[model samples]
Each structure stands twice: as structure tokens, then as C-alpha cells.
Target chain A: MKGSANRRVLPGYGLSLGYTIFYLCVIVLIPLAGIFIKTAGMGWADFWHTIWNARVIAAYKVSFLTALAAAGINAVFGLLVAWVLVRYKFPGKSFIDSLVDLPFALPTAVAGVSLTALYAQNGWIGSKLEPLGIKVAYTPLGITIALVFIGLPFVVRTVQPVLQDLEKDTEEAAVMLGAYRFRTFRKIVLPEIAPALLTGFALAFARGIGEYGSVVFISGNMPMKTEIAPLLIMTKLEQYEYAGATAIALVMLVISFIALLIINLLQARMNKRTISA
Target chain B: MAGAVTAHLSEEASVRPQHINESVLVRIVLITIALAFLTLVVIFPLLTVFIEGLKKGWDVYTASLRDADALSALKLTLIVSLIAVPLNTFFGIMAAWAITKFKFRGRNVLITLIDLPFAVSPVISGLIFVLMFGAQGFYGPWLDDHNIQIIFALPGIVLATVFVTFPFVARELIPLMESQGVQEEEAAVVLGAKGLKLFWLVTLPNIKWGLLYGIILCNARAMGEFGAVSVVSGHIRGETNTLPLHIEILYNEYQFSASFAVSSLLVLLAVLTLAVKKFVEWRGSKWQSK
Candidate 1:
């Protein structure tokens, strides 16, 4: 098959193709498949029991909901940041734009420790917000905050180039045709960029769901309260409950895979609609 | 008018006069939220260490930087990164080359697989290695019989890092390579260059800056890797500890200034990367135009 398509593309079809497949097999498929096999030994009853326990169920809720909330936050603010960077030329714009990737490049442990310090009692803004009866540290909110932190750059970076290349004339025409600002945005601008935005959201959501390093310090790890799924998995591993840990991880993997698949399908549908319209 | 909008673009346009009052209100609200979010998420906590470090004087701050564990951790970081980064760079470049320069069986699947590390959490990355290489893992007994140590050691840290940071260089390289056409490389081939000579004389020149940019980003992430390292590494103080782990140890033991001092060093590296990115972008514009 590649040999046939080789006429259309580059030479050396065999070498690069072989290398790509071999590399993927080694790096990704082997380990992930190993995980599936590892969990296969639990049998149906144990698998269900392991994933549905009181602690596990509670962790599922906190982890999933906080990740959703964080992804939602990133989707909105990320779009705003990307829009600002693309449409405006303010002082320090470049600095802020570059600053977006700080989370991406920064070590997660450092981020975890730093976030804890900043939001803990007696810390700078934590102290200020504490009087308002809002606890930002060692709470579910802190988990969401860290999620938003690491997830922001995904949305920004994913959406920015699309925003940049989006034609201004289309928006101008919408405004001239008696569309209100919000209407112009709703009908014209949003449709064009919605796919990228959704991609950003999905990426962040998947990422937030699996996150550990940034949330560990901030979560307070109180069982039935702030304990996240990944942390719970780590806790299980720490306790030498390897099967139970992998079982929980298998639950996350299956659910995340299904959810992300739906998102990708939605993204593809959106892209198709955009192309047709 | 379109002209007016273009002129406004030059002027860093504020909300137009029609939206002025409302947007000023909106702007204030937005800025407050953005600044507050930044404060809570990034600025304040990061600033705390610096302020706390300086609370004592410059002399103590200087003294803190010279601590043996701190220096050794830094040395280990440089050592591991110095080897690990270049090796990963080679992997990333070859991987990227395989990705972009060919279309083969399961190409889309391969692309998705390459992206697996990014989607998988750092914690999982660590655990996978522990599952693969630890004493209880598959290869564990064999490795032990061979008198080879992998886990809870430097090799484990590097392997975990290579796995975690594997995608970065490839991720950066692929997009740039895709956007960049094969015309130049074809031109080099047309000029009778082959193999390494072709890559060196033709392709490498075009993608050199791109490859460099990816390597630098990869290096930064590899240098600061923590979550995965924390898992596999037993944190043997001076032995398996990297800088970030070292900082965590210091902070845990209440060595505030020393911890801050070491963390500040990591921050400096990050700042340097950010600065280099600026320079790289400045240099890239002309090439991008090609």
C-alpha cells in the first residue's frame, strides 16, 4: 500500500514506514496493552467491585467534575487570552504570550509545591481570599486551580494560530449586516474557531483527569473529599495493592478513552459542518 | 471602517467609544480576575521563595546556593540532562523524520501513539516504568541476576524522563517540518547530495533552527521533570536526587533559604529558555517567509 502511494510522496517509503511502526509498537502499544493484560486477571466481579467501592466512587466524582470545571474554565479564559494575543498589540503582550507555556515547561512537582505555597493559609493571595471565606488551598477548588494552570496553555496554544488565521472580513461583514456584537460573534466568529476551541477543551479535560503532580500538594488528600483518582492510584501503589491500583487505572483509561473518542467525533463533525457551511 | 480598524491595530486599540464605559467596567473586572488568577496560580507562591530567601541578607542567600546537596543535585540534573537530552533529541529527530517524511501502514495510528505520552499523566509514566523495570516488574529478576540496577536509581530517572519528554522534541519538530516544504531538500538532492551529505547539505540547513528550538524546549522539560522522577526514584538524597526533588527535600526539611535558592536556579533556567525562544522566533520570521 505504501509502495503504491510512494509515487505520490517522498522516496524511501519502506525505511521510514518500518521505523514508525516499530517505534510505536515499542513505545506505546506494548506498555498500554500490558496494562490491559495486567487488569484482565481481576475477573469481572473483582473489577466491578474494585472500581465501584465507596472511596473509588467518591474519587471518581471529584476527579471527573473538577477536571470538567477546570477544562471549562480554560476553554473560556484560554480563548480570551488567545484572542487578546492575536487581535491586540498591547505592551508586554509577547511576555504574557510566552508566559503561557510556563506551566507546560515547569516541573509538575515545582508547580505543586508552588501552588500550595501561594494558596496555603498565610500565603499572599490565600490570606487575602481567606477572609472572604473562600479556601483556595488544600481543597477541591485548589485541585481545579492547578488543573486550570496546566490546562491553560493547551487551550491557548491550540486556539491561537486558528484565531490568528481567521479572516477579519467575515467578522466585519457580520457586524455590518446588523448583527449585534454578541450575534456577530455567535454566528460568524465562533463557528469558525469552535473546532479548535473544542480540541483545546478536550485536550485539557483529558489532561486534567489524569493529572497528579500539580494537584498532589494542593488536594490535602483527605479521603472522600479531595482525593483524586490518580492520587488514589498512587496511594494504592504505595500500599502495595498493585492489582487494585491497576484496576482503578483501568477504569479511568476505559472511561477517558470513551469520552475522548466522543469528543474527537464531535470535533470532526464540527469541522465538517464548518466546511459545508 | 476596515482602515480605521487597521489603524487601531497599530495603536493598541481600547474598547471603542460606543463600548467605552461598559468595557472599562468590563476591563477592570477582567483585569482583576486575570491578575488575581495569576497571583494565586503563579506569581505569589513563586515570589514567596524569593522574598523569603532575601529576608536574610545577600550573604546568606549566596551561602545557600553553595550547599553541597544543592550543588550535587544541580550537577546530577546537568549530567542526566546532558546525556538524556541529546539522546532524546536524536530519537525525536528520527521519530519526526519517520513521521513527516513518509506515509506507511498505520500512519495515523502511529501519530496517535506518539501522542500517547502527552495524554498519559506523568504519574502514570512513572508507574509504567516501575511496573516495567522495578524489582517486582517483568524484567526485574533478569536485570537483578545480571547485577544491573535500574529502578530507584539514575537509570530509572533517565528512562522515565526519556519517556515523559519523548514527545516534546518530536511534537515541536513535526509541525514545523510539515509547514516547511520539501522543495529545499529536493533541491539538495537535485544537486546530487545523498544520505548524510543530503541531510547536512540540504535538509539540515533548513530544519536546523527548528531542531534547535525543539531540543531547547525538550531540555527545559527534561531538566525540570519531577512527578515521574519522584515515583521511580527512591530519593536517595545525594545519589538519585535531581534538582526539583532536591528542592522538595530541602523544603520538607524546612531548609527554606536553601530550597528557595535552588528553586530560583530552576526558575532562572526557565527564564533563559523563554528568552531564547524570543530570540529564536526573531530569527525564525525570515525563514518562515520561505
Candidate 2:
């Protein structure tokens, strides 16, 4: 069985592999390379200036901070949601479970408009909050709301399978050993599902950072305040500053890739640990 | 006598400790919080879409859908998805087949590269294409010399869509096909089956559900794509606007009813996608268990 390492039994390997590489290059690789190439064409100083400009810096702060905030919120709430779905059998459970994927399915623009409508000053949720002098729409808080909505499914879906697979006996055994319920959950259950939760947090954070459509309408696009990095890139492009846009995009791309790589490594380690434990 | 009574009680409790789960009060609290969160984040916006669409009455809602620009936007969205979905499906199948069926180095790297689109911002997804094909881009001179346009046109829209949705199908199939392995296909080959015959008669049936699952997700994303398409579409009314872009345009113009009306169509599509996805998952699980 080990001797056939260099040979394959299947036909069309050449053709299929060729087509795959070619299509990937055309549709994905070549265009991504274009970003680096274009950014490289700009002088180092110019590139740095474009990316580190005060306005761009503000946008970065707003984007990263809100994304982090939103991902943090989703981690706690999404865990509770997944836990409830897995542990409890309640009426409308299936309906609630189905709705978790709504963000994935709904068009972001639709989400943006509807959320904005619902949270605007005179709108359903906003009017109630406005009387308390707490603005939601047209603020950073609004951007976080949109990101949380879009990022909810990532956390829930990632954690759901892991929760379902968690053995009940370990929990029961923990109780039998004189461990309290909270201790059992913290020591036994949390360790098993921690990796999935981290992965979901990373995904949601990555998505929230790059999110455009849903945040755009709600954020009000104020230059120094509510503007997101993606919207800034869009603004640069609309301004016909291609080099500037590419520079900002390249920065975001590199950051997201690094974040994903770290998350992947962490998840692999967690899996190995769980297997050994 | 008291010790004897205590021992008996302890034995009974040890024999059947109540299930290691939340108390009824705790369960009720958790469920309430989860449902409240879902209602706020998911259900309310959905309700708003329909409510606002009908705010001006049924006639206005119907009229908006029949608007000429709305009709054109719908057509453009359909056309883009129609083109983007098939191309991606073909690529997905080919890529998955190659990776799963062959033993090769750098395979992991290739898979990572395939997922590049997912990690990239949608705005950047559009920007990359513009950098490659925009007026000041590398191919700009060549395209202009040949009197062809891509940026700010239909082709650009389709390419951006393809980029955003590039990973959906391949990502779905790779894990599935990897699990299925090539033993069955090898057996088929030993029986003299080859090429399209092998794929159609053997592999297709085996992975049909997974493939369908991939296509459903890919189609949904293709139709719902907004940020990337918006960048390249030039916002040319009735020409470059897809349904999402159209919604943005109408919303910006304060045509609330019309925006929500067109949005209702997309909402319907989203619901349909969810329903089909549920059905597919159910069917896929049934097959897998078999």
C-alpha cells in the first residue's frame, strides 16, 4: 500500500490539475498578485504615507476596535446560543437554529438597510433608545451591531458541531467525583470546545474587519469616526486613487492572512491536545 | 437509628443523581436570552424589510417590483449568477478531483491559495481586479488598444463575483471527497471505466449531494454578492446595477418603499436558499448514515 506513493490510479489527473491551476490563477491568484504589484510600483514613502495617513489610521482604529468588540460579544453570546441549541430541547428551537444562518444567506445590503431602518432615530428600536440619549444608528455602536449580525453564524456554526459531539459521560463523571457543575463545565466542557470557539472568534473578527455592505449604511460614513477601512478603500477607489487603495488593501490582506494562519495553528494544537487528553 | 436513615437516603441519591444539566430556572433564562438576541439581530430586520415594503400599501410594493430599473437589476443579478455559478462549479469540481485523487507536494499551499478570496476583503476583491484591469492598471493599455472594456462593465462584475465565490464549492467538496477516497474510483478503473464515464457513473452519484450542497451555497453568494460588485459596477443606473446595488441606490434616493420592495425579492431568495440548504443537509446526512 505504501509503494504506490508516486503513482495514481485515476485518469484525467493532468487535465484536471492543469485546469484547476489555470482557473485558480485567472480567477484568484493573478488578481491578488496585482495588488502586490501595484502597491510595489508606489515609492515606499508614498505607500507608507497613504496607509499611515491620519484619516486612514482613524479608519483602521475604528475597524479593528469594532471588529474586536463585535467578535468578543459574539464569542460569549454565540457560545450560549450553541449551548442552548445543543443541550436543551425547547419549542421553536429548530426555528431559532435556522435563523442563525440568516446572515450568511441574506444580502448584506439588505441587512444594512433593514438594520438601519430598524435602529434609526424614529425607527422601532432607535426611537426607544433615543429618548434615553443613547444613539445606536450612525455611530460606531451601529457598526458593531451590523458586524455582530453578520458574524453571528460563524461562531454558532463553528461551535455547534463541537458541542453536539461532547460526551455527556465526562460531565457526569466529573459530578460523580465531587466536582460542582460550574467546575465540570469549566474544566471538562470548556477545554473540549475552546478550539472551536477560538476559530469562530477569528473568523468573525476577520469578517467584521472586512465587512463593507452591512456597515456602510449604518455607520453613516463619517470620515474620522464611523468610516471603516473597507469603506475607505472604496472611497479611495472612487477618488481614482488606485495606488492608494491598493496600499490600504494590501495592508488589510496581510493582516487577515496572518490572523488566519495563527488561528489555524492554534486550532491544530488544541486538537492535538484534546486527542492526547 | 438516625445514621441508618441517613445511609439509606444517601444510597438512593447516589443511585440516581439528577441529570448533570441546568436547572429549570437556568434553562428558562438561557433560552429567553438566546431567543431575545436572535429576535433582535435576525428576526427584527427581516420583519422590517417586509413591513416597510408594504408601508405604502400593496399597490406601491407591486409597482416597485414592476419598475423598469428594478426589472433590469433583477435580470442583471440573474445573468451574473447564471454565469458565475457554473464557472465556479466547474472549477470546484476540477480542483477537488485533482487535489483529492493525486498525491502531491505543496497541496496544502494550493488549498490555502484557493481560500485567498475568502480572507480578502470584498472591497479589495474588487480593487484587485481594478488594479489588473482598470484604466491605470497593467492591462489597461492592452485593453484600450484592443478597444475592450472590463472595469465598470458586466465582465468586471462577473469576475469580482467569481473571485468572492471562488472558494465555496471547492471548500465544500474537498473534505467530502477526501473522506470518500479513491478506492471506489480505483475499483471502477480496474473494471475498465475511464474519464467522463467513470465520473458520471461512479463519482457523480457518490458525491452528488455534497456537490448540490456546494452549488446551493455558491449560488446564494453569487446572487447576494454586493461589496465587490458595487466597486466595479460604476453605479450605472439600469445598466450595471444588480439587485443589491439597486437596493442601495433606491435607499440612498429615499425611495424607501421601492428599495424594500426589491429587497423583498432578495429576502425571498434568501429564505429559499435556507430551506433548500436544510433539505440538502438532511438528505446528505441520510446518505452518509447509509
Candidate 3:
């Protein structure tokens, strides 16, 4: 009945698309807009003063640094795990593969409490390490451990597929030419997977910065010391500092959005390059 | 002649490309490090939950779980997941159909917005709802006039859960649907199938595994969600406390055994989630290979 130019073969486009937009607007878009609108109502000085306070700045530092440390740790171990899983065959390999996703499947609260118990001075691992004057629980180190638990799968999962699809011909050629194993890997394999690694690092970093439930129990919420950015928002909310919470949330939201945007752009570029190459 | 053949074989073996792979020692070392790290970081903590939960023995474990407040929190968690999972599932299916089945502008932007919640802090996820419906929120006065409660109540809990889980189902289905393409659906349509028939017969079967996979993830998060639900829950004991929040309550009360006992239930759920996820993935891959 309609013009052929605009005609569609299948139906429900309007019904489905309309529902999608409406739901997106109500459930996500409008609520997020509330954050911006609430912050916009705060004047410039108040806004600056709220987010720029010493405590908030300290929280930002802890959050960023711990998340960075956690992401860094995950990048190393995650790469190792991904490399092993792809390159080797061993006993219980599939089981170990599934275990990498435990953090994602496990509740954050459970992870937080369990990690705390494991790391507390009197707890299992903590007791052993206590003799060496190492305290993990209730410290930034504990926070990094929790974030590592949460962000571990991101790096492995992201890099696993890329590694799987990597062509072995180049590596074989390099070895045939007498290149050493390490040198061949460093030159051939690393470049092929660098984008994926960077994407995983960015993903893990973004997740670490925004992490909440897992970090809280281990963090001990020691204000300037152990408190994370998300916990600060929770504290402000509890104290009925709606404007302050809004401002902090706004800042976090923006940073996370920008990080996600960059990752998406990077992935798109990688996908295009992969298709072309 | 036999001695000469043996010497030739030995020489060829010596000239083989043994440098391509890591030495046996190196492989063993790398695997050992990966396993040791996973043991300390993942497996130990997972085991700790159960061990600590039962430290006070089975009697205490069962007694803590049978506590009235614990049961209520469990009920609330189920209720919230019941409402939130299906709603998000419906939204997920619709959004995936739209984004994948048709060519449209701003598709990438739409996908990112759906994923927005993942990048946002869970605390902020809850705070967003509070800002919209709290006592000082934009519609605060209106909700008050109607004797309505969104923040610090059931509605607020559900909203936060929904927001936190908004992307799970859609994220699973979009790539799946995109990869499957529209050829099958078009063929069904051309053969006189229409609307619901087309979907039920064609689309549903194709996407069911993915949809179920999404629901599994969404349900796990919905039930286990703490930070977002914590913000709006108000921690009203047996009234507003979900299971995760209840665990926090018991933990704060220094009822260490009781808290871990409650946590063990979610641990069980998490284990179950992983098991089912493995199944779905297996089935999906099998189907794809067909």
C-alpha cells in the first residue's frame, strides 16, 4: 500500500521501534536527564566547591589510583590467563576457563564480604601475611584486590577471541627465519592483539573506577584513606546532601561516559581495520 | 643400513623448529602462575563464603536463614526480580528487534545509551531514581500529594534494579540477532506467515537461547544487586531489606555467621547462574555449528 521506496518487507517496525524508544526514554533517558537537570540548578561556585572539596578530591584519587592499579594487575594476569588458555591444553582447562567468570556471576556483596574475610588480619590469608607486617584488608591494596576480582574477566574475555583468530602463519614464518620465540611473539603477536589489549585495559579501568559493592566492605570507608568515589556518593546521599551527591555523580557519570565512548570508537576502528586487512 | 637410518632421523629431529613454542619449563611456569593467581584471587574467596557461613555449624547456618527477617528479605528479592527481569526482558526483545532487524540512524548511539547503566556506578543508578522521586525531587511534592512512595520503597527498588540491568538482555541479543540476519524472517513473511505467527515460529526459536542467556544474567544481578538497591531500600529491616541488603545488615550487626549464611545463598545462586550460563553457551554454539 505504501510507496516502494519506503516499503519494508517485514512488519512490526513501528510497533517495536516505538516501544524501544518509549522504554528507553522513561527507564533510562529521563532518569539520567534528571542528574543533569539537578546539577544544572546548582550555580558554578557551589558546583565547583562541592566536587572540588578535599575529601571528594581524596576520594577521586583513591578511586582512580586503586582502579588503575587493579586494571594494571588484571592486564598482566588476564593476558597470562588468556595466553595460556589459547596456547596450551591441560587438565581441567574448561573448568578453569569457566572460573574466570566467577566474579561476574558472583554477587558483588558476596565477593566483598568473602574477600574481606580472606584478607582480614585474623582471616585465612591475612593471618599468614600478618607475620610479614603486610595488611591487606581495610587498605587501598584491599580495594585494588576487590577491583581486580571484578575486572579480571574483562581483559581475558576481550583478548581471548582476538587471540583465537590470530593467524599462526606469521609466527611460523618468523620462527622459520630464525627469530627467537620471545622476539617473534613481541614483534608479530603483540602488534596484532595490541588494540584488543588496550580495549580490555580501558574496559577494566572503566569498571574499576565505577565499582561499588565489592570495594565498600574491603575499603572500610575510612574517609580520606580508604573511601572510594562511589561510597562518597552514598555517604552524601545518606546525609541528605542531594546536591552534592548529584554533582559527584555527575562527574563520575561524565568520566565513565567519555571512557566508554572512546572504547567504542576504538573498537569500531579496530573492527574496520580488521575487515580491511 | 639400520644404523644409517637412525643417524639420519636423529639429525632431522635436531634440525626441527623447536624455537616456535615455549620451553616446557616456561609453559609449566606460566601455567603455574595463572593457576596460583586464580586460586588465591578467585577460588579461595569463593570457598571462604561457605566455610565461614558454616563455621558456627549447620544449626546456626539453618537458623540464620530461617530468621523471619531473612525470609522476608528473600521474598523481597524474589519479588523485585520477578518484576524487573520480565520488564527488562520485554524491553530487551523489543529493542533488539528494532536495532537489528531494521536499518536506522543513530543505532550506535542507541546501543551506547542502553549500555550507559553498565558504565555508571550502581550507587548512581539508585541515586538517579532518588533524584527523580525523592522527597526533594522534581515530582516529590506531587508523589507526596498522591500518597505515593517511589523512593525508599518497592517502586524505587524495582526502578533501580531495572536501570542497573537495562542493558543485559539487549546486549546479549543485539549481536546475536545482528549475526543471524533478517533472511529467515523475510522468508517466513513471504510464505504468508504474519506478525505474531512469524515471531513465534521463526524469530522466537532463533533468539530464545540468547534471550534466556540475557535473562539469566539479568536475574542474577537483579537478585544480587546491592549498591543501587541499597540506596533506595532505606534498610527498613524486614520491610525494605532485600537479601543482599539483609546480608549487609547482619554483617554490620557483627552477626558474622548469620551474614555469611545469608551470603551463602547468593553464592549458591551465583554458582547456579554460572552452570546455566555454561549450558546456554554450549547449546548456542551447538546450534550455530549446525
Question: For residues B163-213, could you state the per-residue lDDT of candidate 3 as single tens digits?
Answer: 988888888888888888888888788899998899899999988877887
Off by over 4 Å in 3: A1-7, B1-19
Per-residue C-alpha lDDT of model 1 across residues A156-240, encoded as one tens digit per residue:
7777766666665676676667777667767877888888888888888888898887788788999999999998888887887
Worst-scoring 10-residue span by lDDT in model 2 chain B: B1-10
A-chain TM-score, model 3: 0.96
Q: TM-score for chain A of every candidate model?
A: 0.92, 0.95, 0.96
Error of 3 at B290 (Å): 2.6
Q: Model 1: per-residue lDDT, tens digit, B250-275? A: 87787767777777787777777766
DockQ for each of the predicted structures, in order?
0.36, 0.54, 0.50
Lowest lDDT 10-residue stretch of candidate 1 chain A: A1-10
Considering every candidate listed, which one attains the maximal DockQ?
2
Q: Which docking category, incorrect, acceptable, medium or high, applies to candidate 3?
A: medium
Fraction of native contacts, model 2: 0.69
lDDT values for all models: 0.73, 0.87, 0.87
Q: Is candidate 1 or candidate 2 better by TM-score?
A: 2
Question: Which of candidates 1 and 3 reaches a greater TM-score?
Answer: 3
Error of 2 at A126 (Å): 0.7
Error of 3 at B36 (Å): 0.8
